[model samples]
Target: MVKSGQVSRQAGNNLASVMSRSVAKDVYTAIIEFVTNSYDADALIVKVQYNSIDDTLIIEDDGTGMDQEGIRNFYRIGDSEKIRNPFTAKGRRKIGKFGIGTTLLEYLAERYVMETWKDGKKITVREKFEGMGKGKGPEAVIEDDPGHISGTKITCRGTRFSKTGLDISALKKVLEWQVPCLPDFTVYVNRKPVSKRNLAASCIEYAFDEVIKDLGNVSGSIFYNKNDSEPLKATGIFIYVFGRSVGNPQGFYHLLPPSTVNRVVGMISADGLDDEISFDRGGFKQDSVKYHAVKKFISGVLESIIQDITYSKQKEPPRDKTDEIKEGIAIALKSAESELNKSLVNADGNINKNHPYRLELLLDEEIPWISRIDPKNNVIYINAYNPQLVVYSSKTNPTSALNVVFLTLAINALAEDQVGANNGNSDLFKRFAQTRMEVAKRLFSNFTPIGHYLKQQQGNDEQKAIAVSDVRLNPYRLYSIEDAAKLFGRDIDAVTRLYMAGTLRSCVKRRGIDRFRQEDILSCMSKIEGYIEIGSVSDILFPSDHESEGAAKHVLVNKIIDSRGNKPEYLKNVGSIAPLYFVKANNVEEFKRWYNGVE
Candidate 1:
């Protein structure tokens, strides 16, 4: 029969355990750890001094020092007494579990001296490790003093490095990196207060603060350096938890795109990550759930920072009329999709599933970048503040100038997919200038215009898509069939179907183009219509590399039928027209409910 009892380590085992964690290469870590111990002891000011002549390093703190019994407790290695109640008497947050700082003294020098005073009594200890002798445990010399100051002073002598002891400059840098900013506490080296570098203030930063569903808040600012200076090269995202650096800085780069990592630097601070700290306080326990949660949140914020950085590149506002020029480009881009799709899409037709459509006109003076393709989000970001574009905006049509830039970007989107598909080994872009020009010529010869969008606002109408107008009762301006789709946020396919089904009646029809009143387009868009394209729906729920379109559609269709007990409705000429299954849903959740077979 066995009974529960006090668990304990045999003599010298605890000391051996702590010494095993002490790294010989970095004696500075031990110094930082002891300084941290001082901070935990509610030290307001810690002073460090080193004598090059004697090779002696001393750290003294005005803190709640310990007596003879307390000195004995310090050797009780694994049993960190402060951890039982990890806060000071005045309620300062303590650096918990208290780092095993003293064991490192043995690695740094042959002799260690400690003097402390508490409760009107004093104790002095001169200690040595068996590792430097024929012993297996620590050997110590103890003495009792009548009185002393209320603080602890540690002295390390008998240098390990016989040649030119530690450099002050190098020591300061190491401590700055290892030690965190203690609240209301200061550390001094040779009477000079050592301060941390202000890496965030060195560059223009984008600040962000977000809470993950009221769980906890993470705040940070991301910095960008266009210069690629050597000083900034070593920088990336750094995370802090409880005033201590966590994980690794390089770990942040692994979570972002390759293009965004080079010039990015950030500092993130989060709370509630204490449980993840390792037994030795070397770093956080990477496999801990808290660490993963914090990382996942930071990953989302980094994506936004990337977008902001890209936009920040544009320094001039759009000299051209933004909406009109965008409308013209929108028309040109639609006409050029087939050419772009040859490269932008795969055979399975999975990527860019939502669209190779839509261009966002955010050409402000504060914005930068002539053209940027976000193929993942299916957006083409452009800075339309160009002289040529401004000149063309005055014309009844700006298709020429607009297509010159927009079509080129569309091709770049295609190249992105092609390059990605070929595993990045194609020499198609070797003679970049000639190849691009030739490709542009071939794609442009087949281009055609779709509609008009440059017009003043008109009277409001309650409903649209009600009936065909006589071009007279038109309170809304006329728009091309393509323009109607663009203005109302409907896809070209959606607008076309609504038109064919007589829900969107065009007032003017001439030469292959049908023009609709804005009122009618509005009504059509306002109609509660929902669609589920197999590839599109698959992209929605399972964004990453996921199930095949056919397999996904079968499951979705069965789910809808079984749950709603109603067969899905398909458009007439579904095979010839767009491959979409329709359902009646007034809201997004309702549409998702229909597709997912959820009530």
Candidate 2:
């Protein structure tokens, strides 16, 4: 039997060892876990009060307060009572893997007290850092002390808070995307509840049609309200507006859907290693289910909203080879111009003029590229040393608003230079200028009408007009040149032309053909445009073909008279009537032979 004083000294040493181990690790993460534990408790309101005078942090939660036994189990260093699935009624799952988070407070505080009540029963736990190290049992330190409240309140002394002002705002920003909203739970730091007005809020709707196996049961719509609402269950999208749910699917814009995000799934194993092209477009792929879900969501949203105004399939009408080629060229010119103009603005908005950067662009693939900007000086430079495939936020300071303006300008200038190199007159530059003005015009023109429609539909409330951040574009299913070619069985050049033509319509007016002409024509064209939004000349050509001086066909095809002197060969292949004429061939030879012989 050891002496009583010796046993007490040994226990005190053990307690001190626990505190020392936890303090050696990340204290900031421990602070985060304390707040997250409140979330798991289904506590809507978590108030973090830092007493500067006392150098203490008081974290109090209105969650189901713990009983004496519950507190003993939950707060112990080696206790695994709370380490379970998160989808419980109380939603308890320990995010702190090491179970040493409670000890972290002991490192920061000289003395700590936890007072709690549950089911009309109250308990208090108090500890002096040095005393605990002197071999006092955990229960020996706790007692039925007075000043206990209905909820749990943890008071830590000897904390180092406010040598500088507390960054509650920044802390709230990180928490917004992580916490779930139950309408009852609200988190407040320094007596202030986290609000959306302080953070950059984007409520994006994500549509996940199905989930692949092996990723666990992580499928659910996540609506992220400004106050930390859970994502919508059906869409699986984390939506954030002014920080509240403004309805879903019906009220908000989608950022990503399921089909697009799936492409990023799958990891490269050691056996999957190849030659130098490992980082190129086809070389690497994502193996993670979570990444796939996110990628699909982003691609879906961008495809639906970003429109091309110049080429309307119904109004322009798809024709034979020459017309298709011409249309493709026109569309390509417009897209290049639109993209360049935006890049130029981005460059000019930020960065110093003298800052030198190189640009290495591979125009072979259509991928987003990056550009650098110094926002303070409003100068832009190109970066050539770093070979990045996609255009995204800058590495140094990604959140700068000037990054977009700077990138847009640099890219626009580069595009202009590349496209204008061959043409002395700088047709490409001219096209870029025209496309910029056109998009601007279209954007402004639709604003009033759209506002009126929105006012009628969702009311003129600013909240309703406010766009929610959602997964709007899905890249996997995006209609690219390759996809067009595969669908039409055409060559790459032909498909490129089709893409150009399609993009042209994005710059056009949204009004119907009747707005341009006296009467609408060819009912079939109207149906196609209505369903597909691809426009063509078939709407205006059929009825007026014979009446006009053949100027319409010439303007449509950008070509001279055909051998028949009535209709161009290309225009004939567009409608249902031409489907029978262009018979499918076994190979390119047969296709060329058949098309060349068309009268």
Provide TM-scores for the models.
Answer: 0.47, 0.38
Model 2 TM-score on a 0 to 1 scale: 0.38
Q: List runs of model 2 lying over 4 Å from the truth.
A: 1-27, 84-98, 135-149, 160-166, 196-210, 217-527, 530-599
Model 1 per-residue lDDT tens digits across residues 181-296:
75577888988887754552224445556676534777765666554433453366677665555555777777666866776777677767766777655667868776777778
Among all windows of 10 consecutive residues in model 2, the one with the lowest summed lDDT is 510-519
lDDT of 2 by residue, 1-599 (tens): 76566444223446545654544333344455577666655566788877677677888887767776667666666444554442437544333333555666665566778877777666777777554446343442444544544567788887644465346555665455334444566778787776532211222222223333432222222222211232221222333211221112222234433332321111111111111111211122346444454345434444442221112222234554434333333333334334444444556534233533322121211212233233322223332211221123222222232234434546555555444654564675756555654564455442221112112222111122112221122221223333233232333333232223332121112111001110111121222221111111222223333322212222233232123244423233323311211112123244334324542
Q: Which stretches of candidate 1 lie over 4 Å from their true place?
A: 1-18, 21-25, 132-147, 161-167, 200-202, 208-215, 225-234, 255-264, 315-599
* lDDT (C-alpha, whole model) for all candidates: 0.56, 0.39
Model 2 scores a C-alpha lDDT of 0.39
Residue 334 of model 2: what lDDT?
37
